[model samples]
Target: MKNVTSLASGAVTALVLSLGLAGGAAAEDFEWPRLLVIGTPGTSSGSFASTNGWGPILQKETGTTVRIVPEDSETQRYRRLTDREDIAISSVSASEMRYQIQGIDGYSQTKPVAQRILWHHNDTPWGYVVAGDSPVKSVQDIKNGGVRITQGVFSPPMVSAVTVGLPAMLGMSEDEVAEKIEFVPASSYAENCRSVVEGKSDIAYCSPISSVLSEMEGAPGSIRWLDLDPSDKEGWNAYLAERPMLIPAEIEMGVKTARGVNGATSNFVYSVPATADVDFAYNMAKWFHESFDAYKGTHPLATRMSMDQFRKYLNRTPLPVHEGTVKYLREIGQWSDEDDTWNNKAIETMDAWIAARQEALKAAQEQGIEVNFENQEFLDLMKEKTAGVENFQSRL
Candidate 1:
């Protein structure tokens, strides 16, 4: 009887240990989807390269297949995200995300899409580019007059505002920029950059890693960048006043054309719509961070997508962080109480903006006013209606 009791106890202990070990293995092996789709910039872009770099590793490690779809502009990418169910994630600039969130500029005609950030991908320095031999040396030279700047005649209105609003960094008002700078018409973003290389325009906005810029660099005329001096504190303050979301980053990683220059760059990020599965978002965010070293060297810009950089700009992004990402951050002990406070405030601010816009739209409809961003009356009403909301500004 004593031997039988001892044998039963040993059997029970063995079964308990087996069950515990199996549970641990199950937790370690995350069940990833068979297929995951990612939308990004054009093939010639660094964003596309970075995404492609990690796509294979993600697939191999998690038993998931990754697909990349390249699109040219924010409008096209956002449209695909909303219209196509297959596109699970997309990349966008801070300005583009802000415009989409507020339903401003190109997004004015449609309702704002509820998007959340997965992580900060990279920061590409952007500034004006001119002919290599041009007399224009700094941003101030453009404000002094006689420079033909590209005015976007394209569908994306924020494209035009970005150029026009940049003068504010140098304490030049919109009216002054209008009076001093020659605004030339460019039908597309490619034309905007090529305008300078072709000698049709004196200056155009450029990112250092753009494939078009390499062409501009090798062109007969050559290309030169006009950097915004970071030492000028007042100028940056004014610049931030106009576009607070932008950051002054020293150019470290980009094409040869952009080396050794300081420029204003918005945080380029990867994000998904609010409708994304919480577990999917959480697992994806965790896996990417944990596997950062595997693909960080895939491209020049990919090296910049480190955990340090992601956390550095986490709180400053225009959109709120995804709930799943927040959960992962908490799990890893990376999240702090301060981050939680900031995130909640960001959510409240977004809610306020949406509510104000809705109220403004209803009032406009009742008053028979044209409810469009192009209409000054509608814009003014938005400002007036949202006046009480904290940190409410109609910026793009």
Candidate 2:
């Protein structure tokens, strides 16, 4: 990936630099859409990097004004893009995508942001780091030692991806694991890294793919990632069984820090919600595929973009592919009978989850619990009860 001139121009196209639409792919131009509003993670994130670069290019290519709106969190961005009343598109973290689709974890109380997959880019490992000077070098050390870990309290990617996955992998519950490590919750990754450097936290849950974490590694206090026990099949099974978005990752030279051989998480995903019109999504995706090569060199992560990664993760089952994406896949001969089967299964799985969501809501109301889940209490309750979520798992 090329060096970004601005914070908004990071490698996420690399993922930020990484690149994405649909009607079975587009045959012609889309009409009726005067403006295409794009939602992305805040100003300095990888998603923002892509937005910052792509907006201008898209405008130049299509002769349309690209309004890139920034949201503080992935959830906020997803909410805006998925809102029927809003005219916008969003790029989201795949980690959060899993939770939002399942209506579990941090999204338990929120409405499902189950939109179509149009574009994909950026695949980074997910995990945490300890001070390079610290003695902790493995998951077991952090799990068994009196290590203090910090993460975003309400952030789904942090909470579900690391905050909770770490404990599950250790064969303990969150409360039980709390006895060994002090859990420090922060509002942002910058704060998490600051806490780590100041000795307030022994570890900060992160990945090298993040510019912030990469910067943290270069700060006064350097850090190293904890290696998971790759041979621990039970542990790996338990952790991944809950969160399927992550695949095994061995990150050596990352966005900032370098890693040794380790059992980290990786996947080729960086996606935007394709909820726009079929023709629009198709044409949009088509243009992106064509323009992708022009921007991949703008950021480190952008340089990681490839057609192979796109084919592998773009159409992962249970995450519906937009018509526009389908068209592109077909045009490239990437679509196959196997994909058709999976896509059908994905539709079935989604139906089950959507059905379960309603069932869960109705059950909550019958027990005097309002279905309106805007607070922590309701979200927690929904996760704990599992009411209708169980049904969907069987379908999956």
- Top TM-score hit: 1
Over 1-396, each residue of candidate 1 has an lDDT whose tens digit, in order, gives: 000000012233311110111211232565566557788989998789989998898888888667787888778778767544446788887767777767666575456557788877888677778888878877788778887887667734335445645776667776887788887888887888898878788878767777788888898868888877877877776666656667776666556767888876767888887756666778878887888899887776776677778776764554678888888889888888988887787778877777877788788889988877798888887778878765422122
Q: In angstroms, what RMSD does candidate 2 have relative to the true structure?
A: 8.4
Global lDDT of each candidate:
0.71, 0.62
Q: In candidate 2, what are the lDDT values of residues 92-187, reduced to their tens digit?
A: 665566667778554666665456667665666656677778878677776576878886776765666566677788888767776786778888
Q: Ten consecutive residues with minimal summed lDDT in candidate 2?
A: 1-10
Candidate 2 Cα misplacement greater than 4 A, ranges: 1-34, 71-80, 104-114, 121-125, 131-137, 140-164, 172-203, 209-222, 229-233, 241-244, 252-277, 298-305, 312-318, 359-370, 374-396
Against the true structure, candidate 1 has what lDDT?
0.71
TM-score of the candidate numbered 1? 0.70
Q: Each model's TM-score, in the order given?
A: 0.70, 0.68
